[model samples]
Target: MERDAVIVAGFGYRRGASASSLHAALALAQAGHAQVTALAAPGDKIALLARVAETLGLPLFAVPLSALGATTTSTQSPASLAARGTGSVAEAAALAAAGAGARLLAVRHISPDRMATCAIAEGPDR
Candidate 1:
């Protein structure tokens, strides 16, 4: 039997919040292909994720920056991460999950906001 895949994209509402997760969870939910989503930087990613989760009535803990994928192309700076509500999103995710009494799942931040969706769909180690 074949198994579906998961695609985590960078944080963004490009595809609209209502459909983002659905599109992200697509592959496995219906077609049994892959579950995908857009991941983003720490500062904005956390709130963005939380907002999205809230809108979807899902509990979201933390969203990390490093987990977001390589940031060499990103304009975000180390200082920026610190300034953002989410510094060290990886650790924050742990903390958030702990506080929310939820099990934290590791996720990667996709990229840009446009085609980055396709990048994350490629999976990690890209």
Candidate 2:
């Protein structure tokens, strides 16, 4: 049976973050995978995600915050927990957006500016 590919990159950023920050983070995360089929982020970060999606020429998805908390990540950040009820927004968003039977292809990676972070997730073969 042929299986469809489902790879996504999820991002988290602070307000006023620049596209360069997101690009850096995405680049780092993509090192683990050759390509990313889509991009995703928390619902409130639609504008930021859109900018990143435009820059990368990929589709963007808004992951509901309610779905974020249940995701397990390789790293944990206190600040992220306080802000979004998740240990790592990038990881959580990636898993949430990828839907059930998803796994992290890349752990969270932060940009040099510390303004943005990204992670990659791959859904079960479908």
Candidate 3:
């Protein structure tokens, strides 16, 4: 069987959030996907992103705030807009990191603790 294309998981979280929160958000976002090629988030969240990446064993990509503005997301959040000038940071980061021709495979999903959110975007087939 042919392997599936890479999926990028984008995350957003509050400062001092735990790695387990990120892991839960990622697991919920991934659904049934066997693996994720990368993890992405805003530049300021590098520390948390790095932790999540290390836990998942995936490469990490930091999405700039400028690039995030142009991303079209399936959902909108006032809090994200107020903080990042975008409706959904997770969606925007996933789309931005996935590069051109990317589309969201999963919309933003918040963790049980509500400390983190995650979304998945599929890049063009390799």
* lDDT per residue as tens, model 3, 1-126: 675666899888888678888888988998976467989999988797797688767899999989888888888898998888888899999988988999898999898889999999988644
TM-score, per-candidate, Cα-based: 0.30, 0.92, 0.91
Candidate 1 minimal-lDDT segment of 10 residues: 112-121
Which TM-score value belongs to model 2? 0.92
Worst 10 residues of 3 by lDDT: 1-10
Query: Candidate 1 on 15-111: residue-level lDDT in tens?
Result: 2433454235322222332333333224444554555545555433344444333222223336436543333333233323232322223332333
- Number of clashes in model 3? 0
Name the best candidate (by TM-score).
Answer: 2
* Candidate 2 residue pairs that clash: none
Pairs that clash in candidate 3: none
TM-score of 3: 0.91
Error of 3 at 78 (Å): 0.8
lDDT of each candidate versus the true structure: 0.34, 0.88, 0.86
Error of 3 at 67 (Å): 1.0
lDDT of 3: 0.86
Model 1 misplaced regions, further than 4 Å: 12-44, 56-63, 67-120, 124-126
Per-residue error for 90 in candidate 1, Å, reads: 16
